[model samples]
Target: MAEKKQWHETLHDQFGQYFAVDNVLYHENTDHQDLIIFENAAFGRVMALDGVVQTTERDEFIYHEMMTHVPLLAHGHAKHVLIIGGGDGAMLREVTRHKNVESITMVEIDAGVVSFCRQYLPNHNAGSYDDPRFKLVIDDGVNFVNQTSQTFDVIISDCTDPIGPGESLFTSAFYEGCKRCLNPGGIFVAQNGVCFLQQEEAIDSHRKLSHYF
Candidate 1:
């Protein structure tokens, strides 16, 4: 008999939490960082970047719902939306649900993540990519926010943990650029990790966002 393979590691900013991977569906290192899709007995299908758990099949709707609706609904009106990161398209799927939205633009730092997720993580996208009102931009999200003159009624930063290329997405400069990219009375939302899990992420993002917006 052969022993089953088990994967264990310290992931993200969790001091003692660990991920024991049961099965690997895809693993690759893009120019940005290590990307992986694996299945765990408890978590079901999961996506992680640089060893940090990102999205899981079972509980994705909770995160996607909160990240999408609170801002869009609070703003009272949102016709155009911009999504940063979330190459998996989970956020995109939620944003497009609103009939009031006229158009959507998503800027992802790495196209590989998008392509990988689109194939291996098809449930997240939910055919939102085919929507005529949606446009995909594969580029550095920070650069897109800084350069694009277009404005949106709602902006969502569904980014990874603050590390590697995602580091720049949480800076004050990035928030300022995002503010500039928004139309009047616009709502901006970011997926800052839970304070208990990744305290710095939530605190740093709040500090920067407060300074800029």
Candidate 2:
């Protein structure tokens, strides 16, 4: 029998599936969770959180574009934007694409993730972090949303799965805080994973958001 490759992903474990890896590029354990960046022959660079695949360089544009554009385009003339948990900055890159967006403030609990992505997965960020209009706040997204008096035309919470440090972003209180920070008629977008894989989280998020927004 051939030796099996190690797949470091909780989702795979949870679903009883497996992930094939071409190479493991970087790995580390943060105070929060384990971070791993690797390459697959098909996916290029892949970033995983606590062993779960978060973003892959190959299909990231599709995700970031849809997540950032739909709400902003529909809202139509947003100036200020607030992003929570997008420590990788891909969402920030897409948000700045709108010429009407004059400012962007991103709140991320893990600064180390930002630095890691900046250095290794540079393609995701596209220089957005260095943009003068973009401001990166290294703090808990939940607290920032609840505490910031500044209102925004759009709020995008590009968070990880609803577990570990990201669990708070999925709650009713967080939704209320997001609503509190929104300008009149402003919109909020959150990337909830596929319902088939995260049924409870998806339904629960919808329920909480409906209650607040």
Candidate 3:
């Protein structure tokens, strides 16, 4: 006779049946709104505050579009792009919008986040994971900035909130590293810290960035 399956495994399988599909209503971290995922999930949002913040099966385009286009347009003729901490590949999707782009690199500290985004947030990023132009480096953004000899035409910051693992990305030292990674005329655009919870920190970052540029 076949051995009986473990009771723990049976219980775990049963628990999965209780899961309720839901969407993200909204997520406002101390630094920014990380994202609202899922249709009926807790923070999933269909129509947000502006009514313009509409939802789809995917949630990455909004963040990617805003972060990439603004800087690309402002700088003009982006040939190469680097993304710091945008593990979800949202920024990658938007960076590819430039036909002039020659290469794109993203340094995200967490490989798991990239995997999750690819699996769960397909619509948000529009399957950017499969794009050939994207090169994902599962390394610390700070480290990548210091080591990379090649410069970028645009550097978009796609870091997490400051409260957790992403704290250092907002520091002056990281900004210095960012300055080093830029080509002569490259534009560096980051989240700039948060305007609300970290207002003072944001001011300080702005001051630091001004000093660099």
Candidate 4:
């Protein structure tokens, strides 16, 4: 029998999680970060970036649904939606479910992340990448939000933790740019890392976002 393989999460030095890898699906250093996809019994398939677990096939729906639905439903008649840093396409899948949302613009920093997820983790996207309302723009989220002439009814920032390429997304300037791109009464949502593990990040983000919203 082949020896079992395990994948360890490098999210924190003191506490983390690990998974038994049933199969190594894809692993590579993308243009922006280290990416990996693997199969596991408990989570089905998992995708990680820079040693942090991103999405798993089993429970991705929970995160994506909450991120996409609550704000969109509350806004009631949102037509144009903007998504920043959701290269995995799970956010796209959930947002596309709202028939009222006419347009979805996804700005992802790494094209490689999109490509790999599309190929290796098809379940996460569920063909939403080809949705008629979906548009993919490969660019830094900060630059796109700051420069885009267009505005949106809802903006979802499905970024990673405050590290590496994602560090800039948590800054006050990014929140200000997002504010600039919002139509009247627009709603913006972001993935603030687990509050217990990243209490400082959560606090800092709230402090920055409070200035604009």
> Which of the numbered candidates is closest to the native, going by highest lDDT?
4
- Which TM-score value belongs to model 4? 0.98
In what order do the candidates fall by lDDT, top score first? 4, 2, 1, 3
Please rank every candidate by TM-score, starting with the best: 4, 2, 1, 3
Please, what are the lDDT tens digits per residue for candidate 1 over residues 1-213?
Answer: 565566544454335455567789999999888989988888788888876778889899999999999999998889999999989989999988998999999999899899999998889999999999999998888889999989999999998867778888888878988999999999888877678877777887788788778
lDDT for residue 62 in candidate 1, whole number 0-100: 96
Instruction: Tell me which of candidates 3 and 4 scores higher on TM-score.
Output: 4
- lDDT of candidate 4 over 130-183, digit per residue (tens): 999999999999999999999999999999999989989999989999999999
TM-score of each: 0.93, 0.94, 0.73, 0.98
Flag clash pairs in model 2. 9-51
lDDT of 2 by residue, 1-213 (tens): 666466756674445534677788788987687888888777889998876788989999999999989999999999999999888779999998898899999999988799898888888998988898988898888899999889999999998888788888998888999999999999999989889878888888888888787
Stretches off by above 4 angstroms in model 2 are 1-4, 12-17
lDDT of each: 0.86, 0.87, 0.65, 0.94
Q: Locate the minimum summed-lDDT window of 10 residues in model 2.
A: 10-19
Worst 10 residues of 3 by lDDT: 5-14
Once fitted onto the true fold, the runs of candidate 4 whose alpha carbons sit more than 4 angstroms away are none
CA lDDT, candidate 1, residue 187: 88
Give the TM-score (vs. native) of candidate 1: 0.93
lDDT value for model 4: 0.94
Once model 2 is optimally superposed onto the true structure by TM-score, how far is the C-alpha of residue 84 displaced, in angstroms? 0.4
